[model samples]
Target: MAQDEVEVLVVGAGQAGLAMSEHLGARGVPHLVLERDRIAERWRTGRWDSLVTNGPAWHDRFPGLEFADVDPDGFASREQVADYFAAYAEKIDAPIRCGVDVQRVQKNVGRPGFRVETSDGTIDARYVVAATGPFQKPAIPPVVPGNAKVVQLHSSSYGNPEQLPEGAVLVVGAGSSGVQIADELQRSGRQVYLSVGPHDRPPRRYRGRDFCWWLGVLNKWDEAAPPRGAEHVTIAVTGARGGHTVDFRALAADGITLVGMTSWFEDGRLHFASDLPVNIANGDATYLRMLDEADDYVARNGLDLPEEPEARVFGPDPECVVDPLRELDLATAGVTSIVWATGFVSDYGWLQVDAFDADGKPRHTRGVSSEPGIYFLGLPWQSRRGSSFIWGVWHDAAYVAEHIAIQRSYLAYDRAIRSSGPHLTADTSRHNQDDEPTVTTTGGSAVQVERAAGAQLGER
Candidate 1:
């Protein structure tokens, strides 16, 4: 009914949004951060009881604080991480509106700002920042056939092996999440069937040192470097079991039966890979090659490194002869549950802005977008290999805040000139000319064009 004004509006008060809010607050930027639930609700509610961080504690910290004397190599439990995030918000004194769900954001007509409509009310702001993460949606593969008898649940909903139905549990998707869930099920005496797929495998540690130590030594984590093509770039796949690596041999040693990729599930029969071991071996080789390439690059770059002590490589023993599939049936194998540790997707239906690309991903360059004053942070692969990591979001958050300050300075100058009167027509004309549209080359005969328009002029 009435207009509420703010300098900036940040949607989602998770790690990304909180980081952005901290930066803005430190710079004295007047802003409000809206969260759909209490801060870090996803981590508190969505994660399983045994869920420990894949990243090391040292690397899993938010901006302005560390995990506090915890084991650097040890993984922080779900609760610990969630509490740490809560403390982070408190430490920064971030002006977060908890439990405020933003419904939509659209360009304001006849005004020099955007209008954000939330469940509570509407707020007018000069800028909007969508800090919602890629994990906004859970991706359940379409190929998974329905079985009313089989209790099905995405990895997000699964908290422990107790939640699954009684029988041999088939865990689909051999990524990090899949492997971890499979291991958990087997440990709980459930017959676990792990679906093998194309996945990256690396040692949890090399030469007795943490794998992340190697990443740092090699400078592979550097964000300032030019973009290496997708093929050359290595990312930390979030759900991978060993953090950076997958140790299938360990799973086998613990009596977990690996299965082929699930072709389809029908009539209570979960048909999966017949050649599970071979597929697992192939996947391991592919990932090892990628890691070797990264190692070579480090050596070629003459990066200094520390000598690591020897460590045992995790793999299946040559003497171990276990059937990959059908080795243990759910009913006979004492398996009571299944957990789907598949991947995630992004959803931004709440925001009414046309800032997303064709793929439905937010369009941003170093946190700045084509939509003026709208910024993004903590995105996967935003500016570097570690952009999405808890430790790395700070770098992006600071960069975005700096850009916002620059823009604010520019806006203040323009406002001052307008209030000073019409004697400076030449300056105003030059400013207007600078905002004119320009043409650029497209790939083919067509051309891509953009106006250097200012948001102060309202939607064009």
Candidate 2:
């Protein structure tokens, strides 16, 4: 019913969105941040109650605000993370509109702007940024059979062991979420069965320091890259022990039954692969490779580091290695619940733009979208390996803000020139090559989007 126009319209008020808002605010850019729920709603509603950050508080700092004042050494709980975001929003005075669901975002057919359809009203924006982050939908496997007698929950919906039925629980996809949930269930005195898969289980702490500390010292953040083939890795941070690693070997030692990938469930029997030991061996081998890399880095840099105890290779027990179960009778095992922790996929169906690739991932060079006036933030490997992390989004946001400012400046200059006699062209002699608005994406090329953006936006 109402038309609100802005220079920038940012969708989603999570870490990425708020970080973008902070940068925009600092540059005196007029932008509105829209959120379907409260800020950091995912942390509030999606994660389990016992969930803590894989990294410590020091890594959670935004640009201006630092978590050092709160809990620099401790991992932040979900509530703490949500509160930190809220506090950051307040401190930055971010222009965030919560409870505003954006139904669609498309090019304005009547004008040269983007028409953002929200639950509250329509917004005509010169630029639209989708900062929804990576987790839009939970990725549950279609192989999960529907059974009326059993309860099933995705990792996003799982709260705690007490919420589940009084029986064994099958945790699928042994990534960070799966391992953590399985560990919790087992420790809570419930029989837990974990489905093992190809995963990177880096130790949370090594050499008398947190693994993240080493990562930071080696500038690993700058060299960050997800291991090829895996969507994401699970760091396996232990809850009560703080920075302890939660590897499969440790879990097995704690009496948790580890199985191979679950193939199917039919007639009260759950089928699994017999390559459970192979999976365990593969994980151990990967861990060793990472450990070696860290050692190599320390040696090459000649950085004085505390000596870790002789690293011991961990593998499954002889019995497990010799004989792996291919199936589990749910009724006999008393398994009444299953939790799927298969991660999530991005969904940008509401955005009517040719900014996505065949895989449904946004096609952006850095954070700038290929589609004019559309950008993306908080995507993994968007600019750097750290692009998706809380501490990483600020750098990308800064670049995006500067690009937008340059575009706006160009627009204003163009508008002023048009207001004068049409025969005179704007002076371009004062500008230098470096002053031109350009951004470098992962593609290793510079893209300039400012030359005629002003005149183009003027028609909106």
Candidate 3:
């Protein structure tokens, strides 16, 4: 196996990885980006053909790149997003090696830095940036005990209503994806059943502005954090007929049946949790809370924003609501398919290090890992609410790059000083050297540290 060394090794060539690469390049840092597949692999293969981002093109940007020749207010389709990243990678001439699967990433205790074992070879990197993103793996629950007669599909594999089996469809987990799929299936004239769960809801438009636009104006992305374990709010907007907010009330009016959380599948029947009405109420409350926040923000800013639309309170129709049925015989209900849109999980099985928290998530402070020389990017609320989004990753990338640059300078300086003599011990005395060297960069940033001409280098 070939052994290659680099100053930095960024895993994943999606928006996050590409952003990191651009920042590192601007700082004159020598780094390589490794992608297991083509750029934006998930966007290319995981999304439904009709899907468009909940946010508009204007908000979709990576570091040093913005969506061009696209409708600023309109959502970018899955293809458009994939193409944008690909173009950005090409435009920046990012040093990306795609089609290389990383087998494992472990600290190089024998020396310093990390040893990245890939299918192709090994990458010995001084700094390793895990830009593989938060949505690396889909979160499908363990199989609901049922006969193999029932068809199951995750949101990632779901394409359209036509792809589903003929009959009523039980769309599980009423987040944005589940609801959207249910809506589409019903619009296609199929019987759709939605299983509700705890979720945040924000109106698509409030006070004559896109919800996201208001979020930007109010600096929502800059929020220190979301509630721990909180999932991203499902922006209840759809891509059909251009784009529009999906009203569950309207869906109920249009014959879509809402049910409670799916607890299990047994005896050839699907069982639902008995908290249907409560979940619906909670979700609606969340929606109002968001609206209240927006209203408060406008008032605090002293902006003469247009008056909010007549506030019609949202609630589940009593007729459509029910004490969760203990079980529904799929055959009797004519439900033939199930679409699970529970969420995604971060899987770092290939990472052989103790960088994760008790929740199995990488423990990092604003992208700086607790473990030195390692970094995380593209995580929801990693630095702020927008960290997971394309528009938000640049900030985190810039900070990570700066840290890496500083660490590099310190290491180089230490190496030089070590080679000087026995007079300078590797203690606090090393800091007193007046003739310490500095790293000069084209980006106008300078890092200073003590230096000796021919000292042995220490791993950063």
Regions of model 2 farther than 4 Å from truth: 68-70, 223-225, 231-240, 313-318, 420-460
TM-scores for all candidates? 0.79, 0.88, 0.87
Model 2 scores worst on lDDT over the 10 consecutive residues at: 438-447
- Model 2 RMSD in angstroms: 5.2
Model 3 stretches with alpha carbons more than 4 Å out: 228-240, 300-304, 311-318, 322-326, 419-444, 447-460
Pick by lDDT: 1 or 2, better one? 2
RMSD of each: 7.5, 5.2, 4.9
**Alpha-carbon local distance difference test for all models:** 0.68, 0.78, 0.78
TM-score of 2: 0.88
Judged by lDDT against the true structure, how good is candidate 2? 0.78
Higher-ranked by lDDT: 1 or 3: 3
Q: Cα lDDT for residue 117, model 3?
A: 98
Residue 77, candidate 3: Cα error in Å is 0.2
Q: How do the residues 187-233 of candidate 1 rate in per-residue lDDT, one tens digit apiece? A: 88876667776555556665454656666766767745534333322
Query: Model 3: per-residue lDDT, tens digit, 1-460?
Result: 4889998999999888998999999888999999989999989898877778877777766646667766877788888899999999999899999899988999998788999999999989888999988777887777564345779888999998889879999888776678778888998999988887767766777877777787787777789877666655444455455566656667777888877778877767888877877776776776788788889888888878788656545545656675445578888999989898877889889887879888888888999998888899888878888886787888889999999987776565555466753322233334433444444433345664434444322323
Per-residue lDDT, model 2, residue 312, is 57
List, residue by residue over 110-205, the lDDT tens digit for candidate 2: 667798899999989999999998889898887756754778889999999999989999999887778888988999999988988777666677
Residue 223, model 1: lDDT of 49
